[model samples]
Target: MSGENGNEEESRGLKSLRQLIRILSVKSGIDEAMADDLFDFLLTVDPEKGISDEEVEQIKGYKQADVRKVFRIFYDLRIASYRRGKHPDTGATRYYWYLDSRDADLALLRRKLQVLEKLKMRLKYEKENEFYVCPKDGARYTFDYAYEYQFTCPKCGTMLVPDDNSKYVKVLEDRISRLEEEIKKDERRVFGR
Candidate 1:
């Protein structure tokens, strides 16, 4: 029963995908076949938008890693925002990409919004977080009460200096701005507003 339901959902998703392809073809004045290619391209670029790597590879007549390589190529060309992250448990890096094309534009927006929220959380953590360092030796401290004593280091007592450069804050802010610009571009392309 569950398998049947899953198949039903998959069929519905494919139907909607075809409808989207037709609409995009009408909007962009492209042929149905070309629009279908574009739609499939978007799905392959961003699997989380209801496409899987295996499915994309099947459609493209390539291996899954080959699809990932294509995604990397597009990323290097600045065509899409490809994300690569390492799994903490397995230490294997996986890549996910986004194409701001019509079929999956909302996925890009949602990803940008998620990044913004994460940046906000990181900024809060950075603002509230404190760091301590030993003056004699350049030992670093990253917990509360790291330098509770005055002008002293736990390892080598000389004179402690607060290492609160907080350079990461600037980096995060820059990333947020870049994502915002990308989201704006996608919005403009989709809505022309």
Candidate 2:
């Protein structure tokens, strides 16, 4: 019974270890064959069954820093890492990797859609608004309000300048427009219309 239990434990451990390796490899953006080769190499070389800097470099054909960088990309994307732990002997940081069981590609798509929707709403509001500025006092106003008040600086009483150079606001408007266009493109791709 003890032997059977031990064997089962070992088998489960091996399977989980393999899964971790695959996640790390995919997150690193390596091709399937290369990632597999790298995974095998790392597993074979890890003294504590935890990947280390030196082993990562040798397996991934990168410097220690570079190999770690590939993993960091996944970190930035929030799509990898099961847990953080410290190395027992060296006290170096280690991250256990996990392939997100959820559909990561679809998640990314949904996130993009949400962003696009927000941008579209903002753009809709901006398109309805026009901006103006006072040349004398540098006061800003919306078009209709400014016109109603005769484009005069409330503080300095100077004629307000047409604020065509609201560069930052214009940039935001441009970004929103671009995002809206992208959303339309994505919709077309999805619905073929």
Any residue pairs clashing in model 2, and if so which? none
Candidate 1 on 126-188: residue-level lDDT in tens?
A: 777776778678886655667466546777776666777468788888887887887788678
| Each candidate structure's count of clashing pairs | 0, 0
Off by over 4 Å in 1: 1-101, 133-161
Q: How many times do residue backbones clash in model 1?
A: 0
TM-score computed on alpha carbons, candidate 2:
0.36
Q: What is the TM-score of each candidate against the true structure?
A: 0.41, 0.36
How does residue 162 of candidate 1 score in lDDT? Answer: 78
**Highest lDDT among the candidates is held by which one?**
1
